[model samples]
Target: MNDLVVQTDGLTKRYGERLAVDSVSMTVRRGEVYGFLGPNGAGKTTTLRMMLGLIRPSAGTVSVLGRPAGRPDVITRVGALVEGPGFFPYLSGRDNLRTMARYRNLGDHAVDAALARVDLTDRAGDRFKAYSLGMKQRLGVASALLGDPELIVLDEPTNGLDPAGMADMRALVVSLARGGQTVLLSSHLLTEVQEICDRVGVINGGRLLREARVDELRGEATLRVRAAPEEAAIAVAMRVAGENSVRRTPLGLELDLSADAAPALVRDLVAAGVDVHEVSPTERSLEEVFFEMTAEAPTTKEKVA
Candidate 1:
């Protein structure tokens, strides 16, 4: 349809001297899952608030589902779980859902179905005050799902969740997307972003760093060849890498690059008369990519800061 579910351009906000959210531009494709990832105080919450219209932007604009974000007309197609889902703490989880339904005018079955979706039906009757942190989080998710929204935005849904709860949250998010729901999720957990997000926008210090598909962000095909006689392997590695980091291991030196690039590096090694053996990549994890991209050692960011 060439339509975007969420989009922003130069969407900025500030409070006096502090720019809470820098000029940020982002887009969520009509039917794709997009994750917003950043560290604490990276302006994630501020940006999200702007997107949802909870607060007015100091400058810039936001559009959701083609309408101005937070416009009354947009709420029907959009659901949200922001800042851990504030609910009536005095009400039972069941009552909380029931109250929300009253306003949506959703059928009685809708609440039960939503609770079942999160596997919190058994705990529905528990008072919000008495529920564990994870249970509360689940209830919030149930609330967001009540209206069968096409686009759902969640912020830190796994906060204080135990491992099992986190797993459940992940399953629900993926299941929602599979069911044709578009989700915009924000989280500080890099692993969660890598797991459930199809694409991600990395934010740092109130700025957008990059956005790419999960696979592209991780990069494919780096082979680590650990061979003995470190000095000899490096002589060959130098020709291909020149500046890439090469660590000395007891077995050999590790070569970091794409698998396709591996052939060129290998060819360089052969041309340099170095024998290569035992090549493998250290496990591929988002953590590795995160560290590699955001490494604080030194870069343009620091140069400007």
Candidate 2:
């Protein structure tokens, strides 16, 4: 069996003369949090819709849990909260979950447990209209977790959440993945995605730009070392990292060289008699990696703003 819970090949979706999603190929591994990252209107929501069969792709294919997508049984092994999950404002949170379960034919099993998972157990009986935006969102998430399906697709799950609410949602997502559920989570929050996602597929202009595991990315090494006496250290950094690779950093001259070249770097530094204070890997955050991997041109709006 394929290790991927969700796979799309050359997934294309166009609206009239406009292309919303263009030949987007992405995968979500069976037990990993795969972040579908892009800016607003970069086709993230459209992509999720296609995966959930809410919208069909104009071209290409989608598969979920070894079964073909767009099939009647596709939803059987999937639970998704697309965009903001729409629910009846009149119904109580518990009633809403019950309705969803009944519609999905799950028949009253662990409804309260799902509610408790989202920290909505006490408010389960509160009318949806009376619930705050965060509370309603939590309820929607609770509904999605009802079936405990193998795959869950969430689009901008933390969109309206405040700081504490965002923290709560983050924990909930991590818990879902830990429970052996594959998540195709779409978010524009690079920092948060970097923290939680095992792998990420970055999108720009409706196309997949990069796919990398966190470890694979972390393995792309650079070193940050401080030299007690500055000039000798700079010269050593230049030799080890090459003249173009050395940069003056806040601490000292930074070496943008492979981690494997550390011995040569240290030897050069030692020969120069530069007191090396700390030699460690420079951890590049996902946002920095995203900037490096994408196009150089700034957004039109960024220029305007």
Highest TM-score model number: 2
RMSD of each: 4.5, 3.8
- Report model 2's TM-score to 2 decimal places: 0.86
TM-score of each: 0.84, 0.86
Candidate 2 lDDT, 116-206, residue by residue in tens: 8888889888899998888877877777788788888887788777899889889888988998988888888888898899998877667
List lDDT for all candidates, in order. Answer: 0.80, 0.80
By summed lDDT, the worst window of 10 consecutive residues in model 2 runs over 296-305
Q: Going through the candidates in order, what is the number of backbone clashes in each?
A: 3, 0
Residue 264 of model 1 has an lDDT of: 74
lDDT: worst 10-residue window of model 1: 296-305
Q: Candidate 2 has which clashing residue pairs, if any?
A: none
- Candidate 1 residue runs with Cα over 4 Å from true position: 230-251, 256-277, 291-305
